[model samples]
Target: MKIEGIVLIGIGAFMAVVSVGYWFWSGEPSGTAMLIGAVLLGLLPGGYYYWWAKRMKPRPEDRPDATTREGAGVIGSFPHGSIWPLVFGAGAFLFGLALAFGWWFLPPALGLMLVAATGVTTQSRRGGAI
Candidate 1:
């Protein structure tokens, strides 16, 4: 993770330097903005990873002689299956159809989408399987 953070910071710095060059070459505002945006995109993740590495405790991989087996363990809980995804998909489809059809279809579609989202969010609290 430390190495990853260093690499990301390097990449971000490189992008920023390149953006400066681009701005010097072409004085166009849009192009300059894009270049600056690219620099920002790179820096955001780099900064996040760097901060995370500093804040979090070192993992097994941080050790010089750590083995692959040393890092092996259950990652986290994952849902086996759920019906909410299908409901969400249906709502999405309806929303898309509403856009192509009439205004009357919009309300119902939006309502369905809201309901589906709520169902998915509350399912776990209700002891429902994912």
Candidate 2:
């Protein structure tokens, strides 16, 4: 994570320099603005990851002396065979189809999405064996 964050920050820094040069050379705002946006895309999450990395204990992978066995174990329980995800996909499909079929599909789509979201949340809160 720390290395990842550093790489992203490096990318953002490189882009920033490029953007400045591009702005001066082309004298165009749009391309410079997009380049600036790219800078933010790299920086924002990079900063977040770096910040969290600083606070977290280094993982087995992060440690030089750690063995493969040190990392081999159950990390945490994750949801399996979940139905809410399928329902959410169905709702999302309906929403997309509404663009061509009619505006009438919008309400039902939204409703289905909301219901699925709520169900997933409920299931997650219940913990283990979804």
Candidate 3:
């Protein structure tokens, strides 16, 4: 039903049909190609089943996606998100300054950048989580 499964099925069917056609038309080469095609067809269905089973199965909490209830859709935006953008800009400024000056300032500047990026990401996710 999923797109990946449909694609695999279509590919498998196509390969199988082509292989059969070749077998009737040609000789040893066709037989080799048929073997390869049949192998591919078998693997495709096997992979599809494996993925389906994985999706159908469930696990305990403590997984990153355990609490993810709904599909990933658009969430509400943070009204004050502009502040985070400015924070990121300041971090970039500091980073650039450190680069121009010396390597000694690089660590602090990188730390600032990391903090700014983390704050922005966390704030955005928190504001948007539904």
The TM-score values for the models, in the order shown, are 0.73, 0.84, 0.36
- lDDT digits (tens) for residues 28-124 of candidate 3: 6847676667759755785776588567643323244655564355555646434656766777887888779877777777777788788877776
Q: Choose the strongest candidate by lDDT.
A: 2
Model 2 C-alpha lDDT per residue in residues 1-130, reported as the tens digit of each score? 7998998998899999999999999999999999999999889999998999999988898889999899988876786678999999999999999999899999989999999999988898888544
**Ranking of all predicted structures according to lDDT, beginning with the best and ending with the worst:** 2, 1, 3
Query: In candidate 3, what residue range of length 10 has the lowest lDDT sum?
Result: 57-66
Backbone steric clashes in candidate 1, count? 1
Query: Candidate 3: where is the Cα deviation over 4 Å?
Result: 1-75
Q: Which whole-number lDDT from 0 to 100 does residue 117 have in model 3? A: 81
Candidate 1: residue pairs that collide: 81-130
How many clashes show up per model? 1, 0, 0
Shift in Å, residue 109, candidate 3? 1.0
Better candidate by lDDT, 1 or 2: 2
lDDT of 1 by residue, 1-130 (tens): 7777888778778878988888788777887798778777777888898899999977887888888998888755467877878877887888888888867777777887888889888877666445
Model 2 stretches with alpha carbons more than 4 Å out: 72-74, 128-130
Candidate 2 to truth, TM: 0.84
